[model samples]
Target: MFTGLVEDRGTVQLLEKNGSAIDLTLEISELITNDAHIGDSVAINGCCLTVVEINSGTLKFQAGAETLEKTNLGLLSQGDQVNIERPLAADGRLGGHFVQGHVDGVGSIKSIDRDGEWITMWFEVPEALSLQMVPKGSVTVDGISLTIVECQPATFSIALIPHTLEVTTLGQKQIGSVVNIETDILGKYVQKLIPLKLDGFNERQ
Candidate 1:
């Protein structure tokens, strides 16, 4: 599990393709000589990837076909910047919300506006994934946890402070760029629980 708070930005060093799957190698900015080990899961642009290779400030992971079909990682090119976050440790500070590092669906940047010290970004959510959102609720976009400032039927807006702009990738995101989206964790559970509760009530009736 992750908090959707990006620790740093990494560059795509190399990509070893094998049909639909590929070995993704990312070079971290910090010098991580030996801390990173094999089989460690790291959130890359909100997608949880296991570390297949870890060197000094560089790591490798296998991106399977499922990830390619569902995310924008498949569209990435060499030298592209990617958001990177290490897995949440047992004693780590949970600064952001409970982001599973699971990308629900991909969304496109619809609009971008700058206002004083803040910025507003709107994303057009895909039809299938729009059902699980709520106004002022939690959503993870490209692994950056954000509050749904305004939720429309098919689109949503989020407000970012100046610090968020400097700390994460959302600030540099372009208008037409695609982003990974994960809806609220609690909201999904509520949907499942409500149906079962209503069914039990009907049976009692």
Candidate 2:
């Protein structure tokens, strides 16, 4: 699992397609690359990927067909920047909410509004996913954990501090740019259990 806290940004060095899968190589930050080893799980743009090789200050990962179909990683090109984060360690602090690095669905930037030093960005999300969100709830966007400022029927907004804009890819995003989104895991669990609880209550009544 990941905390949705991006440690550093990496440059895409190469993307090679092999049948239905693809091998991704990134020139990652030295801080992460140096400590990384084979089989370590790293979240790339909120998609959990396994380290398959480390070569000449670069890290390689394999993305299967399912990942390519579900995420924006498939749209990556050479020199493109990607958010990178190592999995949360057993004793690590939960600075951010629990992010499984499982992209629920892809969303697109619909609007960008700025106020002083803060930026409020709205994303057009699938209606089904939007229904699971709440105001002030947690959501992972392009691997950066953020709080939902407002929730709507088919869209949501989040406020980004200046530091967040400077450190993550969201800073470079523009209207119509696609992003990987992971809704709150806790919310999903609650939504799933409510129906079962209602059934049990009805039986008791």
Candidate 3:
């Protein structure tokens, strides 16, 4: 799990092809490198990737075909920047929300408008996952946990505060960029369980 709180922005150093997998190398700040070990998981742009090697301020991980197909990571190159976060500790505070580091769908920046001290970002969501989203509900966009302010047929909007804008990659994001999105894990689970329970209730009825 992660908090969607970005620790630092890192650049992809290299991408090496190995059979059906691609080895990703990232060079992060020393602050994010402290105590991190090989086999540890780091969320890069919202995708949980295992650390295959850790040397200097750089780390390597392997990305399979499935992960590439599900996220915006495939669009990344050697110099692309991504939000990075270490896995949450067992006794740490839940600063953001429960982020599995699993990208559920891909979204595109549709519009960005400033509202006084904050900004309103509208993005397009796929129809299949739109059903699980609601006003005031939580959604993880590129691993940044945010609340849904509005939901449309194919898009949703979030109100971003100054701190959020300055601390994460969203600050530099522009329209037409693709982002990885993970819907609320709790909401998805409840949506699945409710229907099963309803069937049992109806059978009793």
Candidate 4:
């Protein structure tokens, strides 16, 4: 599990295709790699990837066909910047909401509206994914935890502070740019349970 807090921005060094999968290598800072291990789980663009190899200041991970099909990582190119975060520790502060580092679906930038230093970015997402969101809810976009300012049937808007724009990959995003999205886990469970409860109530009536 992760807290959706980006620790550092990593640069994609290489992408070696092997059959349907790929070996992804990223050049990150030693702050994360200092205590990192071979099997440490790192959230890269909100996707939980296992560190398979570490050399110098780079960490390597393998993305399978399923992961590639579901995330924006498959669209990554060499030299692209990716948000990176280590898994939350047992005693770590929950600065952000619980982020499983599991990408639910891919969303594209719909529009970007700037208000002075703040930004209100709209993203077009799948209807299914949007149904699990609500205004003021938390959602992880490209591994950055942001609050939903407005929720539509197939889109949502988020207010980005200047700090967020400066630190993460969202700063460089453009219209139609795809991003990995993970809806709040709590919302998913509630969505599931509500249907079951309603069915039970209808049967009793």
Specify the highest-TM-score model's number.
Answer: 4
TM-score of each: 0.94, 0.97, 0.94, 0.99
For residues 1-205, could you state the per-residue lDDT of candidate 1 as single tens digits?
9998888888899988988899898988663325677888888999999998877779998999999888888988898888888888999998889999878889999999999989999999976566688878889999898888888777999999998888777878899999998887888898789999999999999
Those runs of model 1 whose alpha carbons end farther than 4 Å from true positions after fitting are 31-34
Clashes of each: 0, 0, 0, 0
The 0-to-1 C-alpha lDDT of every candidate, in the order given, reads 0.86, 0.94, 0.90, 0.96
Return the lDDT, model 2, position 81: 96
What is the TM-score (0 to 1) of candidate 2?
0.97
Q: Tens digit of lDDT per residue, candidate 3, span 106-178?
A: 9999999998879999999897677788999989998888999999788999999998888788988999999
In model 4, where do residues sit more than 4 Å from their true spots? none
Of 2 and 3, the candidate ranking higher by TM-score: 2
How well is each residue in 56-147 modelled by candidate 2, as lDDT tens digits? 77999999999988899999999999999999999999999999999988999999999998899999999989988999999999999999
TM-score of 3: 0.94
